[model samples]
Target: MATFSSVGVGTGGLDSAALIKKMVDLEREPLAKLETQKAIVTTKISAFGQMKSLVSALSDAASKLTSVTGWNAVSTNSSDSKYVSATAVGGTLPTTFSVAVQSLAKAQSTASAALMPLGAAVGAGTVRLEVGRWSGTPESFTPGAGKAPVDIEVSASDKLSDIASKINGSGAGVTASILSDASGERLLLRSKVTGEEAGFRLSVMEGGDTDIGSAANTDASGLSRLVNGSTVTQSAADAKATVNGIAVSSGTNSFANTVSGVTFTAVQVTASPVEISVAKDTSAVSSNIDAFVSAYNAINQLINEATKFDTTTGKGALLQGDSTTIALQSALRSAVQSVTTGSSVFQRLADVGITQQRGGDLAVDKTKLAKAMNDNMEELKNMFRSTEGGSAEGIAVKIKATTTSLLSGDGFFKSKDNSLQLALKRNEADRVRGEARVDAFEKRLNARYSALDTQMSKLTALNAYVAQQVTTWNKSSG
Candidate 1:
């Protein structure tokens, strides 16, 4: 851009500002071309960046198949899932066994006599809760180790509802609520866990004057009335089950450690033995293969779009005719199609039902792959896992190594990006220099035009003096 404030005003009637602007624009032509070139290069760099990300993602997916031990997957099934459900927690040999659930675990529950109104005041005292196992018909008391009793205080004006709230808020190992019927309202207590050892006992002592009850902490009045008159609605119980005719018991319905690497949960007592089976997880292996295919397809798609050329439009993609991009596309295709060079039970990806499609993407054959994973498991593992020597490495190992190097420092992508960045820097420098030249040109034009204006003014003054002299002579002569 250029501007001239006092150009062509004296000597000529020309649009000097417009002329200066045109000249400056001509001078800036090179800078505009430079900007266009920089934009193209920057676009190329961004495309390469996306390609690198996809290759790195492919590497991650490949790495999962490089370890042989990681493929030790197993699936478990239960014949009667309604009664018992089984799961494989760790690695174990494939086997089948019978489970007979004799009884499910049950929590202990107790209820007070339904004789008090909803708001009827009950005597108050310090009620202590002792948690432990309850056994035998006589029900002798034994304190659980490391469990200190929790004591709660009650006032004379407190109703059964208030006691229930206090019990719930005390953090005791039991839940309390009030149940109402036509007869009256009764307080109900249940153990927090469904096991014999989760049972709790309640006793009351003197809290203050008039709220005191029997000194033995058991009587028919005060807070002790709840425990003394409460009936055991459900006794604490443990789950009982049999595995291969051997009896097994658990405090809860879940039986985790009965079998090595196996856990089963009982929902109901089985009429007969429920069979549980464990086997190699073929579906898991298939999923891993699918992940590998998906990652490879992503890389393939990016390269295809970036390098494609349209014949009808006479236009090419960003990476079209780029030697580096072509080489990358070729290398990835070769890696997938090439056979394993090292000691593998299976030689190539195709040997295990994975094959390249028309556009260089991989596709898995579900039925064939499942059979290979089931019957030829060891061979499939060896094909995907690496051997000690690099000469006989697995396909995954080779792809991992290649992708890792490409993403590393001093790789092709790094060098290309660095070169493009330098070009950008140079572009900016060239723009600065170009602008400076335009400024110098504008200055020169202003100087030349200023001198012409001064010269023209002097000539006009001299002409006026000459005209005045001629007019005086004519008048004198007349």
Candidate 2:
């Protein structure tokens, strides 16, 4: 065999770095395309989520509209016809209502006499008097003992009434009043509060002739007994006071009681305007029905958009013609049809002026609707507003239940959204993984190319060195 020179053997470089570089570059296109597709899916999913939230709110509002039974409202107006009046039975309860009530009373005890200043006494000489509670200064006055309290006054203007008033106002734990009955206007004194410990006591200074009741030398403790014999000793002015025939523990006072499931609040005087009414709010049912219809329409639109696909454009519908969409559409249509076998008022949709056109869409017949609203409003209300025990008693209930189910958690929209979200997440993960592979492959290819270029340059330099040496040897030998 002929000898093959090392130059020829080493001429063809063993490096495939350039080929690897070209392969890695070609691989990047598929990964980039996948990333773009994933981004598009993410945008579509986010939009669908927002739409789902709005639809859910509309559905909840519809359910509330359908279930309303009575209007609970308050009005401060005095002349408004809606005001509920108190019952005729002594205390106030709403008109057309009966309330069981028991009356109560408050009273005072242990106080037999009123504190009198010595100035009211009939003594020939003046005696100083002080009337005030403990821990306070007394208001001083002078009196002449044993006479009409008015005649014994230290001043021309002062009388029994004036002295009683001053003593009562002294914060001495008693109240004073004028009892102008058949017995004449007597200065009546009573305790401010109804308790044995709260009764008033007084001291008379420098006058042995004064007794509390005499007006003569009406001593500090002169009024020792009640004016009347109806005992437990109430002030004479409070003789008629009684609460449900239960004797007051002491003196007369207003009281409140909650008895026999009725609340009775007594005031010193009756002041609040009594109210009574017996009419239902008729517009509430109609408003509820209208709200339900609007919400149903909203959900219908959402379903239609989600499941429909464009045949000409080859694009999937937003929710595109899915089973959930079809079911919702059918259920809503049936509910609006208003089938009632027993009720003459709501036997069909046409009765209520709801018409289904040839395009499979509902249209409101305003003229017929107005007639139905005016003539058979009660029947219409019964058809949609009445429900019992969690079951659809009417068209309105059925529609509300179904709409709520579809929009709430674990419902059609939620279930589908979860699926789509999972799909999007997986797609993005795959795209990212593919990109990473592409990057690593490219880096390896470039490193190989650099190594190959360095090796080739060294080989070429060695070949030049051998050629130069050969030329020098031939020249010397010749």
Candidate 3:
């Protein structure tokens, strides 16, 4: 009655263990099918995630076209860019103007008397720098309004190089450096920006004992030399120019507000007036159109690939024959082709040179598009942009509406994804129950087979004993 590890060890080698194994495997067929279905659902859900992202991108591109402000970009042309260069933005009316550059703004620069000896101590004290305007031959400084002096303290052992480092790190609105020459190194100070207000003035806040001066703030000794002994190399001045025959002055060379919505930078004084023209920027319109087309094409390509089927290989894509995806493809194409009477200018995409091709992708006719934009820009703007007075929705508006629905709370993506998740849950539940049932079945088969082996073993022993007794009786009778 001893049990053997091998399943086919008893029952006259009937191999009941192998038979049980085959039956158990056959029972798992349904669960295997469930597993395959679960895999398919999972892959389809992942594919939809990709589709939703592309649709969102298309929506973003469409949203940009819905705004009227984005279309107000203008192309500004200057007759002489060498003298004047300009740019236009933000609802600037198309107009031509004349500009004459008389002078370019300059920054004030100053130098101190050379402190002889290469490594001479420049005296210890605080160097106070002020941003202001300077005038007169001897130089009288007026600090700019609301400006505060930035102080840089010096140590007794500090050389001109150390003091220069401290000044440069002080954020004093002026750059400082040591200029080495035959006499020695001198402190050079220059305004960081070109403007009358950017001019800088230096004075020592007398402190550490070294070279004391009669006039601590102005005398030519110690750090005071940076002020009293300094001479102006250049004077601060505003850019002098005239726009449309009216003279205008700017602290900097660039004038942004002289002309409404038009900014021009004076590069140099011109011999004659520079003519400036503001025109509609057709290139920006073209770029927006191209972006929309590209975004739409991306969605189209994704749908095509996701639902594609290969007949030769007997294989289909993850979302092959999906109704939701197919409907989306048709709806988008219909939106592009639909005509809306709300727009008074362009009723259809084709009117703006946007044509749908045979492969369901949009193509742009650049020459035709340019002509349409040049001929009637307002109408073109009305085509894609939403306006007041409640006209019919534009093409972009229509497409964006569709995308919003698909990505919304009760949208197709959410609904479809939720369904797939439920299917996965059901698949797991079925797998767990089916495995448990098969396991119990295998255990039952084992128990029954084990009992059969014990019975067969006992019968074999009885047969052997009976045969021996029969042989001994026959021999005795003989």
Top TM-score hit? 3
Residues 431-466, candidate 2, lDDT per residue (tens digit)? 778878887777766665556666776888898999
* TM-score per candidate: 0.76, 0.49, 0.82
Kindly list the per-residue Cα lDDT of model 3 for residues 288-348, writing each as its tens digit: 8899999999989899898899999999887789888899899889878877665676889
Tell me the spans in candidate 3 whose CA falls farther than 4 Å from its real position.
Answer: 1-7, 11-21, 79-83, 98-103, 116-121, 157-162, 179-183, 208-214, 242-247, 268-275, 304-317, 353-360, 363-371, 389-391, 428-478
> What TM-score should be assigned to candidate 2?
0.49
- Between prediction 1 and prediction 2, the one with superior lDDT is 1
* Alpha carbon lDDT at 236, candidate 3: 79
Minimal lDDT window, size 10, model 1: 208-217
Which residue pairs does candidate 3 place in steric collision? 342-392
Root-mean-square deviation per candidate: 4.9, 16.7, 4.3
Question: If both were scored by lDDT, which would come out higher, candidate 2 or candidate 3?
Answer: 3
Q: How many residue-pair clashes does candidate 3 contain?
A: 1
After superposition of all CA atoms, the RMSD between model 1 and the true structure is 4.9
RMSD of 3: 4.3
Full candidate order by TM-score, most accurate first: 3, 1, 2
- lDDT by candidate, in order shown: 0.82, 0.48, 0.83
| After superposition, candidate 2 runs with Cα above 4 Å error | 1-25, 68-280, 305-317, 321-342, 355-367, 386-392, 407-409, 466-478
In candidate 3 the C-alpha lDDT for residue 380 amounts to 79
Better of 2 and 3 by TM-score: 3
